[model samples]
Target: MKKDSKSLYYKDYLKLDELLSSQSPRSKELGKEAHDETLFIIVHQVYELWFKLFLHELDFILKLFREKEVDESNIGRGVESLNRILEIQQLSIRQIRLLETMTALNFLEFRDLLFPASGFQSVQFRMIENKLGLDENMRLKYGSSSYKMPLAKPDASEVTKTEKEPSLFKLVEAWLERTPFLEFKNFFFWDQYSEAVNNMLAEDKRHISENPNLSADEKTFHLKEYASTEANFEAILNEDAHHVLVREGHRRLSHKATQAALLIFLYRDHPILHLPFKFLSKLIDLDESLTAWRQQHALLAQRMIGTKIGTGGTTGNVYLSKAAETHKVFTDFANLSTYLIPRSALPDLPENIVKNLGFYYSPESDES
Candidate 1:
């Protein structure tokens, strides 16, 4: 049979002609082309294309979270979508290695032609950060300049609008705050968790005091460290203390939301809680993976141009390294590990709660 007239052609469907034609090296226009300019342009263009796909998956995940009451059936789908973004980030990091193949000397041939036009002007990258809840205030200053200062007016306007929208971080925190499992009937999670945590800490103190291996100096040091650890724990267990940290900008999650997360973590084995646990874990992974990408990109920049300013006119790797550390958006979820107690130390949840956590079947039918 002849191919149908309506059938998709591989080149037409992917718009390969347009993509292949888009790379016109500035060095080539200047009458002495840098052989590596094509590689440089192509790498960044590929990153932009990947950014487009990343936003698509991220948009779907954000939709699922935007709901007043999240549909449980869609959670796994959201997580799978997030995993795709995570993979893309990994790919983004690996692509830098490919860029590295073009040596610094090769980069120098045409680097000046692109002056004042830096990767800092990448609007799509800014969009991803804004969508993921990177606060503008948290952004490192590029010499008293907003990051958007480099973008064209239209691009800048688009990024500004993203700030008004609820970010993924905001939505997830709200969902955690509203988690129903925190308080049920007589199952006051904080009360039990506090008691367990105190008991666990007291046991720790006993070991440190009684251990024959520790000298008096070591014992004193350990006790002071224990007090510090206990204070850190109190910062979570006490609402007033939690609020104080929030006010100081050291913590972001609300007290109730933090407590809910701690409880879910402690009893993650419960069937109903497993999904939430997975969701939290994925966010942490995504956050860390993205940070790793930023650090790698910074290193790549440093290798390409040491201590010099970026083509975007910023203090190249310095700006990037600071951004990597400060740009992270999911610290609250990652920090929850500090609150995690051993499985043995977790308070036994009520039987009724445990049964409700998973599907249960009755041996006898209700109909007689």
Candidate 2:
């Protein structure tokens, strides 16, 4: 049995005195002391705290992926971290409901006092975005200036540092590219998968053309849409096409990584790939949760201010809506569903490959 050398109190341990005193509503400072301003400040402060925790979990995941060879156990741990992150993101989205509780008129009571200081100025949020692999080039400008324009010198500098670092997206792509099962001896997963895709597309086209209920124009329209889907599948099947899409900013994942990710998705039932599949799924969930939060925030802003500009001088909800549409990071993983064949159509793996992908007991080894 052991006790701490120095006794600790809950308030002291958590610095509750400092944390509780940090919420200084601008309305109060300006002598109006709006009742809802305190809630407004607390909501944003809580968001920043969650953003900090996000960075902590991301840093751990990033470290694991940075290694030359990430152990399966580490991938499991990374999946656990991502699960926690997804939970936090869901909570963040829910918190917007609390903000919505304040009426537009109530928000305006203290909103004017928050001039030139919008949620756009949150440095930690920017860091989180950077760490998650949001491309700098893809960011929307803040009223003709860079998004970093509103941050203080030190905060901007920290964000710049994070931008240069390898993001979770980059690390995961590298890890996927390094996946060994994509090509095992005579079994080339993509070769088989590509054939399956072509067969599936042909079947779809046949079904569309043979539909007895469809008119000529309806068949034409459906055929045109099917052609576009075929082209999308071709982009992944052809390395040069995939690269062209990457150069055009239509895709973020590299060709090999995309293929490996596809393999993981198609064969997620394999024991060895279960963790990787879960990890990738969580990443998609994380991206989706953030998008959901952004969408909710945009709605909240529009509800609070109508078409008015944000206190930070931006176009408010318009800017947030655009960012939500474009800020996604793991969409490629989600879009892999486009290429997935039914289990009935999936290519059977060689016995040896299946053995490698599953855990098996060996009585002889145990006897030794």
Candidate 3:
């Protein structure tokens, strides 16, 4: 079949025309004298775009979890989305290092033009902090989300400054709340069953169940306390009471599966003992690659401008070091410490590896 003449591509759906022409040079001198100014503009703009996509994908995962869709297929897909977000984050960090290639002199060429401008003012970044479970109320404490834009439209600049983006932490919290623990699921199931039993006992809803408030704890407690008041009536409701008592005996069993599931991710060796083990191992390699990127950024910053405060008024190399600490090579090995050879319990070895030849367990006496 022939394609429709009105068919629109992804770019068409987006307001690309507005975005494409959004960058403005400080001056003809800044644009012409500083050859890399355009590079600076595009790098930050591209980073913002990546952040936007990350927020979108993460929001999708949140909605899926909210709808009680936690089968293997959904979880697999959610993890895939998370992997993509992590990849994009790694790319943004690379772009930050790329800022080092150009001289601060080039940045200084237009530095006076920036006035109070700094990447520290990025609100999208603040939103990311909130998403990651950082205190949202503290954005201004660090100077992010409070800086005003000097050159953009009032509304656009205001939106950029004020809007708090959704984060992964919020998504996970929502997931845990709506997700039924086995205990809750069984309670809900039995509540329905108890209603049916009550109906059976009362031919026309006259004879309510022994515990009319089976679904509610306070009401159940009240009825139990008043049981002696209605001791004679209890005989009439003995069958229904007996049935509920029988179900309560197996209540723990019903909740056991869900409780066990809660333990698997962190308790039973989990992804540490599963396929994510391989992904984490590979990620360790990627960690080295990423650390190389950070080191490269520091070196590049030195090459461009040594020991100088960042244009955004940050202590350049020192600030980057703090950012570098946030990057973990992998997390699977992290949780394993609590379950296995905990880091706190591990004895510190002697400085020389050759001096401590018998550090590891002997194979013959290692296990039961």
Candidate 4:
């Protein structure tokens, strides 16, 4: 064999040296930090690894969404990715609790050692939000000294070439714009769903027109209404394809993605989709869990560091509590359902079953 190029070895290949050297202990006595500081560092590293997986899944799902053949099958992939994302989130929740096991007394040993560090700077977490189409203007953060994202920005907006593009949300928003109006309108609950979406879009447009401070990107999004549908819209649902997407989306590995989409789809469709509330109950459970996690995190911080400012530069427990409160799950949608269900006729069920089944909505019945 020809001699390997000198660059092919350690220099050009794996940067193992740099990677291994990244973990720098603050004190000479590495083992002296109480309450498993090594475990703390390792756990955070592991969390980042999971977030990386989420980013991968999100990218793949969004790509599927963009294809011209977008349907339940493609959407299912997004759902599966979502499910995997949820698994990672569950692990994160558990990891968060690991902090509770250690008292502030124990943390004090390594408190000073952990100079400027907090989960606030998690780039991968931001990537997940971007992929899901959450607001990104204030969300994106890089070093104040540097103008560009160290990693590629998923969305391209910044003038500075040094700044990487923005996140996948930009791409998803564009994809939504390109999506054929007929195809989106063909889903089971087309009319009402389209109405809700249009309403939201209309509101967005008004806000854009009136608001002086709206960013250029926000204005562009509001001005261009990509999806348009009439109130009496009726289109063929590719039953086979739809089922395939639903099944794929519901795959255990992609629960969160599926859940998020389904939540949106159901709300848009309203009484039309008529999916079993039992199916939605799972999402409700997840919402409860997320809320609980936030509560616990706030408590843990309060107990550990008291009223001190966080390493992330905010009032520790107070800031954390507000962050937790912001994650309200399903309050708006749940409220909306009260109006939708009673106005429509109930689905056929066994006499006894019908009598016992409390007022509930099922998405499955919307199939037409």
Q: Rank the candidates by TM-score, best first.
A: 1, 2, 4, 3
Model 3, range 1-368, lDDT digits (tens) per residue?
44466887555568788888887777554555456777778888997888788767756665555554344455556667667766886786677767776776777666567656765556665444444434333222233533233224554454443345433444443433333321231234223333443443343233233445455666555556555534433422354553454365411111222222222322223322232233223334444545565566666656665787766666667665655565432332332222222233322222232232121213234232
For candidate 3, the 10 contiguous residues with the lowest summed lDDT are 250-259
The top-ranked prediction according to lDDT is 2
Better model by lDDT, 1 or 2?
Answer: 2
Ranking by lDDT: 2, 1, 4, 3
Q: Compute the lDDT for candidate 2.
A: 0.87
Which residue pairs overlap in candidate 3's backbone?
131-167
Off by over 4 Å in 3: 1-16, 29-32, 67-69, 96-98, 136-167, 170-262, 265-303, 326-333, 341-368
Query: Counting only residues 3 or more apart in sequence or on different chains, how many pairs clash (N, Cα, C under 3 Å) in candidate 1?
Result: 0
My TM-score estimates for the predictions, one after another, are 0.93, 0.91, 0.50, 0.52
Candidate 1 lDDT over residue span 158-263, tens digit each: 9999888999989888888777657766788989999999999999999999999999999999999899989989888888989999999899888988888887
Alpha-carbon shift of residue 95 in model 1 (angstroms): 0.5
lDDT-wise, the better of 2 and 3 is 2
lDDT of 2 by residue, 1-368 (tens): 24466877677789999999998888788787999988888999999999989989999999988988787888989999998899899899999999888999998787777787888888989999999999789899877888898899998999999999999999999988877767766889888988998898899999999999999999999999988999878888999999999999989999999988988888888887788889999999999999999999999999999889998888888988999999999999999888787999999877776664431222223321
Q: Write out the backbone clash pairs for model 2.
A: none
